[model samples]
Target: MNHGHDLNRRDFLKISSLFLAGSAAISSQVGQALSSTNTAFAKDDREEVVHSFCEHCFWRCGIAAHVRNGKIYKITGSEHHPLSNGKLCPRGTGGIGQIYDPDRLAHPIIRERKGGKSSLRKASWDEAITYTAEKLYQIKEKYGPEAIAMLHHGYGYTFFKEMFKAFGVNKFAKPSYDFCCGPRLQGYTMTYGHGTGTPEGIDMMNSKYLLFFGTHYGENMHNTAVQEISEGIRRGLKIVVFDPRFSTLAGKAEKWLPIKPGTDIAMMQALMNVLISEELYDKKFVAENTVGFDELWAEIQHMTPEKAATITDIPADEIREIARTFASYAPAAAVHPGRRTQWYADGTQRVRAIAILNALTGNYKMPGGVVKYEKFKLPKPEAHPHPHFKKDVWSKYPFFVQTKPENSITSHEVVQQTLEKEVRAWFVYGVNVPETITLGRKTAIEAMQKLDFMVAVDTLPMEVTGYADIVLPECTYLERYDDLDGGRPYRTPFVSLRQPVVEPMFDSKPGNEIARMMAEKLELHGVFEDSVETYLDKRLNKVGSSLEEVKKTGVLVGEPTNLYRKPGEKLTFKTPSGKIELASAQLKSAGFDAVPKYIKHPEPPQGYYRILTGRKPMLTFGRTANNRFLNELPTARENEIWVNPRIAQKHALSHGEYVHLKNQAGIVSEFPIKVKVTERIREDSVYMVHGYGHYYKKLKWAYKKGASHNQLISKADIDQSTGAVGFQNNFVTFIKEA
Candidate 1:
């Protein structure tokens, strides 16, 4: 309930409603048990229920598509599925808009150069595939197979990756790491020796004390986490959050520390200083399970709470109190490893601090701490041959590990380097790389422009599609039979299926079919299954279930078992020293800092503020930004700049006044946006929801309607440990209309 600065009378009123609403919701929704299971597939005469997994967001909640008169009328989360637990967030509920979107590409398109201008022309699937295959082969012959680089996203991209690998090429790109949770993944693996399988491995429901830094559960809309956190709150769970903005998680916290940006490491260091100096850490667990504790203790000698307070801009007393509260709860307390660690240049070390804090608390393998994800193993495709190629940009970072052995390069780095002709061909699937990657939309467009050939596979006409030489139309998830969605670790392990509720619309084909067709054309058919259905059946049969049972039940739940290490076991780690490294010997050996340390980020230049971006519940980055039902929501459509009232008054800006934004690098926004001058944000920072300011003319609902944070970001600072982009480093000044 604390404000960093005084709010103007009008600004106070505007934010009062937000604060009140958040307060009321927190009081009511927190600690409420999850809803009772209700099968969305009850026998109904008017509608038929078809089971599938939602592609709305990466959460992949199980969905029951309601087919009425051969068209999908509604989507409901499957009650039987553990992830969904009979509920869907706003994005999942608005999935119908995506399927029936008017802006959807109806058929394959070929961008033809006429009068030195590119124009899209409709082409037959046969003609499109033939042309695409011919161009890829030509690129392979002329510049070698290594010249072909692919950027893909999600489980559905398996075919695209395999097909390229079958072509003896292994260069791949995904923004998931460099732009998202690469730091958390690397830090967790180094500390725990293996990545927390998909969906994350936090046991929030059992935790009594939860410490969150920069992650928003309700707004992020990870169904299981939201449900669990709400239920935990009802159980009288204590929560603490550190963020500049009053996020949903912050509003619910017992204490909300508006810590200065890029000072998370200082706060973490102070927490460790208290635990180690006070001898409050679990001594038995530390002695039996960890390595390099002496080194860690020695490193923390200078990291006093007062010292951290100076750097973090938080009170030393509160820092001490929080650290005490965290250790008081012991094994049941957890420091939630945040998902988006692509903040400052030292983000990897920041997450490493989080990992170490969890380790010091002896939280792993305990009821309320970090738990292992139990996964159901499925059949892996026959290993495809891949030729050794030039390392992609991700390989430069010491901490960046190959998520898979075949591909280790950073796609964004490659995209940026493509301007210098490092890569010749690009196969973009499922992701909008140009918008998601750092260094702005212009850099992405220029890289695409420089490519020898570009093929975009998508269901909509996005900005990337505008620059592609060929556009392959894909059917929406509702109209496709993708592989099984289940088999990952979760509260309960389960397998969900994605089946077509209706036939493919227009001339668009399923992603698997597109992959198969490409493979057949390239005479690499052995790399793919005969059909997507066959692939699903093979995976389902491993668990004594088939495609038919999944269609009937919506999901197949696995029996619960103890997946975590037991009460008494020899503890081991995968690090170079072979134990949980309190002070990483590997990092020290690699010449990086052996322990987490505060690294100050550059302050904003005069007359500019740091631009901070985050998610909105209705929008999932760029994918659902154009969803009609979702985008029509006021919060989803409006990309207002959240400027502090003091800053606004100084700049002669008023509420609702539209202004252009120019970043420190001299890149200006493509459009003017409304401003919300309030005390919700810090004076030194401006906040905006990402995934706006669309330039694609065909997306009438989203084009030029709001400001794009990406356009204002022209510079990218690479994290030395992870090769991930420190996306929040840029600063921008507002430009009022004349």
Candidate 2:
């Protein structure tokens, strides 16, 4: 539809064709049932659905495929799904590429040397499993169970962690715990009591005011929030976006504040001062619901308008005006808790500051705000507690738990660094580490190099797979049945399962098959049968359904509760406070500043502009770099830096100028750059789209097209109380190469 400001008159014809194609596809894909009944099938195609959950990105959306004989024809969002509403993102629709990727490992390959670069060769399933398990056993016997580590990415890999624990390996990690969202969870649980992975859900459509700090839900590629936010925009909600870059969502926002990266805390505190000084804050809610106000007030008193002005580049008057707006809107005004918090060392504190604003505004547990959601109930095969490991490899690492006796290890802190000393081998399940690791690619590479044994379970040849002793090619989500985790709660109440849409295109196997094989090899067949179909059936029975039922319905949905509101009654948080916290009492005791504070980020030197990393909606972090549909989506090519024309002229840099961007890391990449001088962005910083300049020659569309910001990042981390890396915190000099 509406192209809005992104429209160009001459480009209209091309846009029309693209829009029509996309719309027609969406229409057919969304209403697959209707289209299926009308189509005539040739004997060349016998369509059958293999139910599965999507692993395209982390959302794990459920799907039931339409297959013809042995080949999958297409994949659509499960109509019976409670969460997705039968809608899939572009990535989900592009499932075919992953299934039929040409470079997919045909069979397991063992590197000739123990510590060596991996090359593909024929490997029998038996030999691969036996050799890998034997090596793990050897490492356990020699260096102790702590010597072996497992780093998992998606929630599905929790099963592998279970396998590790069953095998007496306790040194396991998932990026979600430490590097991605750990600090924010720590901040929230330390303050309020529970942390949600995304916010159970954001009530954007009904909210009056929507405020964001570092979150960009629209471009973040989580479709649930993006879809809802779009609805909110249609309803004309007061949407305010606060981030350094002018993102797609920010461009659509009523107000966009292009602040300096990492200066959020100062602005938030300034707003708090305004709220309290003018009595705009909800006094009743604060008095009755919160504790430690005196301490918080004491700090806010000193973090005055003048001091906040100096700390945050935002002028004092603007901060006061925004604070008035925040409190003025009150109750239903929601602050979005975004995905990653491990960007800056101070990330936890930053999110805490944002949460504090929520408390002051009395938005907690209210409709049209951050509602306290009731957990969804589903029947699943019972999973008991993990068995005691030989030793706790994560014993040295400290993690913040929401409840009593809670202890979980931080992924960023000690889990990774201690890999060589405390851990001998690693089992990587469904995670791409090289691209995900911040500023530690070399260190990660070295650690992976030292491993006695390792295995990477994925579809394509990811960067981490290069070092794997065994690379098990996994079937795409379209090909196998997964556990109920995909539609576990938010998506649907009925346990949706993934089945085969086609016999795997290559010699690839589903992750479950690999798991089952490992289980049998380790003689844990009784406790853990690694068959995904068997597990799918087991979970199906719990939901009062079976594999046959899943095949018929595609997905199962519970009765819609009028709205996806907290439902029936308010849900209790997993945090110790029993409510939301602004200033955490638990954090105060943990040797970290209890209150979220403003700390000036390590600035990039003058002349060297800081480059912030972001992605287009069509692609994900280096995942869809191969999708031809998306590859040709016409992104800003070259290392196109968004520079204000004033600065461009001052530097004698014209539009599409070739330039050299050098950071403190001594890394440089060329740019056939387009100079975007616009009011939407800041002149001090240059911005470029991520996933460009794909170094891998195999990735035809993306390879060598532009520069990778990740390559240029200096190895400094933020004060990760916030659990994130401020890659935008680095400074660099940009020169017109002429």
Candidate 3:
């Protein structure tokens, strides 16, 4: 019951402030305290600490791996790292679970078909690498390098990316782009000419009022964001949340508006109308720093609160009042452009509306408003020359992020192309393909089954690995050296390191080593250094830091960058017009709406409710689905479908009953999910955590734990402009347990 040295809420708050102080002594004290209490460490065992970043999620918070007798016994937040400061999420401490998971892929495996029956057989690293490279070359020789595509999710994919590029195979994709960050990134790029980087650019700690549209910060638990939000709450910052379900974030809000799903743009337009009509908008800021104001006004002039109230289901007076309060906060208030925004087909426009709202309130770069965080200016090392990519753009979408040379297509496009046989080979790295949202689980599996050659590089034997022709066992983050993480943007810009805390277990190898082996087998000359450590040292040397220096604290910090704009400063944006685009010229040129428009999405069919999916605070979908340490908590054990009282009664579902969900396409769930009948959800929608209901037998802890959200997504609405897949259109009906 003690749960070791548990930090109470008050104690956590006290230490949370110390994170900003960047005190090494405080970090040491904290780390020692946690390590001393860990029963797994023996008093006689020699102990050492190694600094690295977490791989549980993309936020990549720094971690301190406490090693006893050459084995990591505990993990704690690194104080020297800017992102985590000294605090870590549940997932960070759960790295040990991943590293020691019994289900982990321990060696290289190749699927052999004998007498039309296929089975995986363990193979030596050289045999596996050689076979994989040969097949990839054959695919390239027959179909072209473009025919070989990769779907990657983790930081480990960097080496493979370079390897693929050296081989002239440029088609790459990340599933996160299709279902998560893509819409918001493209939306902000279209309006502000840049994407909102991780930790987001919100100055929450200094803000008076924060407006959120279904952004569950508490549940999502991005380290810096959560820390700042908690600090902001202590400073008496007011919050307003718009979500159909009363999310953990909504529970902390001064106002929680249960806005109708798929009508966010309408509500945003209504707020703009009120701000413009009531003359509450920052007129001077809009006139001086932004273009297409007239065009934006014209589009939203008739979108009054009264009209939006009917569409969004929030009272007209309430909408106006919220808008007025938001405006009254002036440069301190901002409407947060929420993450995982690919809900409706108009997702990009939805975020654009958020951008326009924030701009109208004159909160572009204010201390308590929206600001652009800077990244550590780590210079890149020279790269080996390779053949130019045959194609610059593979996505059919017009406005995919093109600020940099994008050799990849969208993940959904990859699925479509694979089904079409245009993509003959696939390299899946650290992503569970079937669970990762693309067109759907069925379509993803179909595409994988149709592939001529498929190689999966992962730590665990996830479902995707079963479909692979070759499986390369990748060591867990605690046992790997990845490329330096300098891309994360923050107030005090810092570059974090990911170094091995222990030797890799079993026959599994680090991603860098695997990539180098593959590159060598393919005869790709000079693509990689003699060793991963050498490669990292060379890159770190460019920034006047070495691997040895960074290994001490796991991060190299830079001076804090100015995040706010000066008063009366001339503003220039990266947009074609050189100003904040209230109406995007590029979108218009691409034959799309210049300004965001609220298009009506299809309503749920009779006898069915829309399925809303989110994450549990302790788990991040697939990454933590099989993590035993994190899953030990009561809340993390399994996911349940949250049904409203009205819907539960209509379906004769009790609070503790179990039911299977059938989608609109009549695809029933494989496992029955526990029903949580509560008022937290709307009668028209049911809520469930994603990344559950694993059917893979190898995932012992996660198998048949809950219903899979991805499996129910039989319908997909692709955003034409950005190629992001919108899946909120799918509806589900309950089927009582047999």
Candidate 4:
């Protein structure tokens, strides 16, 4: 090679810069052109379009796809959508990558042997289903249906349970409760005695104050409420954020209280102490609309500000100021209820304290604040009975999830205990377990090992399928029929259709069709198994709409509607006492302290830090971990340890330092992260992202992105009463490695 072929460093640099600028300009133009292309699939530039929803992050926002042929160009949130408001966060806009993922599982596979971690053998659907049903029969014959446990998470529970019932396994639990959104139900139930309404869109557009207890509404925006919150902030709403980390929401808030982790109860109680002591509470509203003010006041009086402030590490004066600010805002001030409650051991109680604040302020069911969650009533699919299992095995606990669905213990605890052979098989669908569950590297193999058989049904051969004995390819949300809960109705209510943009790549089928097919094969086929046409007709006709109608319009308007707040209307709290409970009667009856108290949790050793990790608003755990488009958006294991700089400096720590996080579980992993050491974090605590650190080498990009947070955690410290692991109660201490 000629020496001159290697251009001088300066000349090479100049040429490279020119090339980069040209590429960037070209890319920008492509993005602009792509936006205008109605049919992205056109070979001659035909604007091919497909109507679908973005499943990238599980908010499942509906979208009309632009596809010309087989190639998917780009995606945008359904602006016409009331829920999505024609807007999408970064992930939703980048949803096209999922449609054409090169790594997408393209065929049915059967794990031949029971042991050896069930590698994919590449089987045809005929062979796969035949083997699966046969094993289902064998498992039933050998171990009874109750011996089987189904851990199903994600949406579309209705269509996936056919096999669980057909196989006669009643131990069906969705990881949603364990992995997320479970704590909301628990707190709501404990307070209101009923499952809560869906995540109510905080009417941020009209609110004057927003208190965030680790609530990242803007970061996780999808539902209309998130949009409302953004609008409110734009209009200068006083935002107060309380978290251990200086989160994106916290950065935006007018005030950020870096409270100690796992002691939110103390902070909330301290705020209550302020509200009561200052007499900022709405006495008139409490007297007219509530029932147990005297008792609640008396109980909180015992939780003095000094005690709560001491535990939460929030200055008592600041606590008082926050309380007064919140109380003064009246119905215009609201505390945001975040999704994904399955965090610490005290997760439910923490949420309960926050929800009760609404009641205390007489903000219950009001405008721009604690408003009711209104969902458009859609026609139900035909009520198909889960055919009586050949045998019915029920949980002795008579599981009580405080809120709707996702009681953590009711799902994984059931699965793990049953797999230790307490349960024989698992028929699961609508989720990818290995990704959704914590400590997935271990759980994925262990869960599959103890079962007599395992079947997973999903749109892709997700990580969970690697361990599945039988894999059923299910369609994406766009190619399936399902129920939707959080979208605009007066914006218009209509059944949205997810027609196939392309053929079912391989043996893939929609859950509805899969359920029907399984029903027919299992000998349970009858009125329910007749045909998709008949079932849709039977079910949809009741709601004054039909499948065919939805297919045609993509959605149906709920009609002229009005859900409003009548000013000066009496507020009604949804508790047994019909008032906010400073001292929960349910807590008292459960043989626990009535007041929300901060109890000391198990402490980690001096050398290790207690790592509290959580879901990224950009990517739901492991869901978008594989989508390069979404993964490249932001926060791919930028292992940020939210520590007090005071603590970091003492340990000779610096930002961007690489340190090993070693836990008692013997998990030793190193991360080179930007130490977000700031005053916003507790001196003793740290936090990072979960769902990184993929053990599967095949996951190419996701492997070792960050430490496996679950590895550092010992699930041994579960809340006995609820059986959910107290993720917060387990503690650790930080040590700086030289």
Candidate 5:
């Protein structure tokens, strides 16, 4: 829903009062009411509108920030943007809450060890930057540039990435790669010869049948994907969901199969077996456009529906019927490659099976199936001179995507190297290290303690900042001009800008300025030779556009390219064999299974259940956890552990009862979690929203609000081929209040 509608003065004041009631540190000017209705505002009241992109989550939807009297009043979706399509998520509207949060990092600080007690003291930006640069240089001199690494998350990390590259620190890791998108990316790249684009190339609006295995669209709240799914539903799209918990998307599905957790590969193999044995697969497509069909069939030939039913708990007859129905839809059906798919050690293979299933149906580039989305082709500006980055591959995984300069290794690998004394210093940008699932909170802290130096750049005093040798407070997205976003792939190719909506509030600076300062401190020249505006304009001018024109609309749109494959067109993939590899030779060469094999994961012990994690629709984990506006809703207040009624009965737990969870490794949850005894989940598993239970006292709103899902991850099952950390192997048991 749009948040840009007109509001009367009384309504605006009421909202402002309620918003400011939570914290005293919020600026009084920020509490000033701005009535969108012309009748409610005085004729002299100054008003301005700034169009930019959002940083609430990775989708980066276009936002129109409403500024009245030099203070941001509201944010709404830009109609010109393809991702948002004039509709914004709740997190986008809550951007004000983040900017006005009381606990935001107001200034730069440096950790000092005085009288043998470590404490964070306020420091000037110069002092903080110089100190951080000197320490990083010292580490580089002693341990070499390979010793320094950067663990980043948000879109603001582009500048710091360049700064690190200039300093000869090529080691970089994005934690989301390790825990969320790594397996899916590597799996699809291996099978299809290209990674799945951001707005995943799903032709949802034209689809007749869509299959989802734990991909909850509604709860994830990716604006464009959710909007397309709604449109697809209106056009008679049928959905089949296989998940342990009945998610928001499951509620919209025609069928919700509560498949056993960690048994997705078995179910997929059964589907393949049904298709091949019954001659339901597209024979023409398999022969003309795919490779390794015989090898794939041989692998799945014995994984019959009856065999999978025993492993997945779905009836054999039901599996066959679903497979037949899916096949009946032909090119109009697809098994969606879900996000955050790193569940078991075989996650890459599980997704590979999904790719094979899609290929078997000839849905590779079909209108109603998987299509390739394109990014806006923006020419890169000339680079500044620097030493060639060290080409050392840190991850031992043979199939790791080492060509990607942004994230060459997994964050867990960085942690391992840090513990091994190979890595000496760290630059953490936007990511909350302990809360983000790298190797778990304990191991993350251990690596942090072991580091010779650590610098954290953030908008708030998150858990990561508490451990930093130097903390540089970055302004919120509302007060920043980040690099142009031409990387997001979409149906209508476009580049979005991130111009400032308001002036920087406190002593905080934008990431671009922070990185530039760090570069100057390190004696790096010509890297940031031009202002951010000049640099942006130069890049935009190459494409016959300017910063002034893009800033007005927030995005520069391009003609929509054809997504679907034409009839009888030969599809040439970028694989080694130049076709879709059903049985990947690259994987085989690396000693991995050429065809996906259903390997049984470890089961929970007696009285324990598998811990499943997801996010709420209104919030985006740590990004919006402390947002007062977003957190005001009852559902957004905190995370609840979803337990099946039978399991609750067995544990003598009641709905709304507070209890702590103890994991298989004997690690207890730091805070108590509310039990939600419902039949919406499987009896063998429990569900909780990720990104909560903040132990950092500075995060007043998010502190100890819910149990931390990452904390219970005492064991990480690493995908050997991709290095994606799988935490679903860890199980938890209830610890009822005494």
Candidate 6:
């Protein structure tokens, strides 16, 4: 808001260029090291290569693990696989680290009591399973089947979700949707008639323009999308980014707008206004392929660039110019839907605005825009209906309930219910809620303490494990087999295999085996009745392939098809109107605005700044926060708060000086972190990479190393349509150390 800030902006651009070059050099060296084949162990020593999918962070890249004398030696990208294309990101490169980490939970353990001082003792798998089954039955008989709830993640989550349902448990808290990508998926599904599958279907190869709003592909390290965007850049694709901080991708962008946080909708609305006012939209495409265009135009007529400039803090001239550039590019340009759509209460409508922009430019199913790929069908076991429960998504968060058939419960809504003692038991599998969820660590601990019973299943001993009544040690991805990843949005949708490169260490068991064991104990049939390999074989049969062929090739391929929709193909949508709902009658009927309108986000109080968090290339958000190889990378070792130089001076804080942070709720980070005084971030905000400040004492490499952004925020503003927990609305100020 001040002219003096312009000087800081110019300085930031120059400084960021140098920072990126240094970072790139470091990344290249690390990548080369990881990809290099470790030939110290001779191939003749009972060595072999196994094809599997990397579960390091859920990109599901095909990986080849080399085993020597019954031990994994190295991991590399599968050369023939479609997703990786003989390349693996930094996180994927550390696959061996995850599998061989010394701190992994190697045996089942049970806590005698609740609270922090409760002692844990090692137990056999039989004892653990029997205890869990008996307790589950007892709780079900007393409190009803709805008393059991689950919070889980990882590739095997599908089976566990069904297992709970088969056991007649109706409550669940799977957080992937509410915490990460629910709003984005819901918005796209409402507008385009289908959800944009992960590793999005964007055809970046032929695109002329790439528009990003707080989404940085390079930083996120989505393997295929990074490759496509790099190729697009080489072919002269113009990149525009709108973010509060100068992120890794922002350094490479042709145009970077330092947008005010929580104001993306205002900027998008202004773009639509300019396109509609100057007749820059595709008239032919609109008339034939879309519905509700007239209503959208009428609503946007009052939202001029000048009005938007006041809310977004971006120049009016720049807004008009960006709109023109996008229109001229026609269907080749796209507004990329971001993955982390949990920023504000109005997140769903914000994504709807971007969908409207795409519709106006006729980008759906275009060569360089959004495309829909065919999904590989798998056979599901027959399910019997269970009694509906009162405390469910349909009762509490009906507006956000997904229309498409899905079984997992809305996570945030369940967490809220946990506080009120609505559930009696909880099962946590392969997720770290203490470090990753919104609110704060203290709140999570309180909720866990209140549960009648809690069980955790993971390879690593995490904070959640410390609170569990029983802890089941699950084998790592490399030590066991998992379900196939039905490939990406590419023309040829390939299915990749996950086979064990080595046997499970200690007494750990594969997730599927654990699920099957429980199913047998509960007398639940059909699902999990067969071995994981047998199920995979049956599923592959649907696509005219077999487990044998998949193991040989690592991936089974389908025939390629055109990326764009044919001209004569009938345009259809799954919405109420059977067309693109640009004006969104669904929203209007739900007691919400039909069109996205600018709402002023709360500003930080005097002497405080908004806390903003994002991903780093080497760190994958709490999953690998303790990975030794990744932690060794300079950028991923520990997080430093990025503060503007002027703000640093104002607080008498020099670079590398340690300080603690306190939020509006008086919640403080336990550890102190060093300051990074730079001009690459806005003065009103301080930036930190997520996935640090591990409180689990056993995670030696990550414990008390850096400040956790999650711990500093205590507010929860859930999105109306998705129940996404919004933490970006939190404000904090630094506390100087003695």
TM-score of each: 0.91, 0.86, 0.94, 0.85, 0.95, 0.91
Instruction: Write down the lDDT that model 5 would get.
Output: 0.84
Query: Taking the tens digit of each residue's C-alpha lDDT, what string does model 5 give over 293-380?
Result: 9999899999999999999999999899899999999799999998888887888899899999998998888878999988899987
Give the per-residue lDDT of model 6 (tens digit) for 1-738: 111112110110111111111334434433443344654322335768887888877688888888765567788888878788889998888877776676777678876644524557778888898899988989989988877788877786666766777777766565767757778777777777777776776778778987899997788888988988899999988889999998888988999999999999989989999998999998877887677787787777888999989888899999999999999997999988878877878888888888888889988888788777765444544453343533345325545655543534676555666778777788888878777657556566667767788888888777777677788888888867776777445656777888877666567789889988887787776656467878888888876788888887578766664667887787788888888788778777877777777688899988989998888888886578778888888888889999999999999999999898888777777888889999889999999887788766677679888888877768878776566677888887888997
Models, CA RMSD each: 9.5, 8.7, 8.9, 9.1, 7.1, 8.8
Best by TM-score: 5
The candidate, 4 or 6, that scores higher on TM-score is: 6
lDDT of 1 at 430: 76
TM-score of 1: 0.91
Q: Whole-model lDDT, candidate 1?
A: 0.77
Global lDDT scores for all candidate models:
0.77, 0.61, 0.84, 0.60, 0.84, 0.76
Stretches of candidate 6 above 4 Å error?
Answer: 1-44, 114-117, 377-395, 403-407, 487-489
Model 4 scores a C-alpha lDDT of: 0.60
Error of 3 at 352 (Å): 0.5
TM-score (C-alpha) between model 2 and the true structure: 0.86
Model 3, runs deviating above 4 Å: 1-44, 405-407
Point out the worst 10-residue segment of candidate 6 by lDDT.
Answer: 7-16
Candidate 2 local lDDT, 5-50, one digit each (tens): 1211111011111111133443333244333443322124455555
lDDT of 4 by residue, 83-172 (tens): 565677766766655544444454566655344322345666667766776777777778766666667655666655644555445566
How many pairs collide in each candidate, listed in order? 4, 41, 0, 41, 0, 0
Output the TM-score of candidate 3.
Answer: 0.94
Tens digits of per-residue lDDT, candidate 3, 336-391, equal 88888989789899989999999999998897898998989988766654667454
Give the better candidate number (2 or 6) by lDDT: 6
Write one digit per residue (lDDT tens) for candidate 1, span 604-663: 899899988888878886678778888778778868999999999999999999999988
Model 6: per-residue Cα lDDT at residue 497: 82
What shift in Å separates residue 706 of candidate 4 from its native position after superposition?
2.4
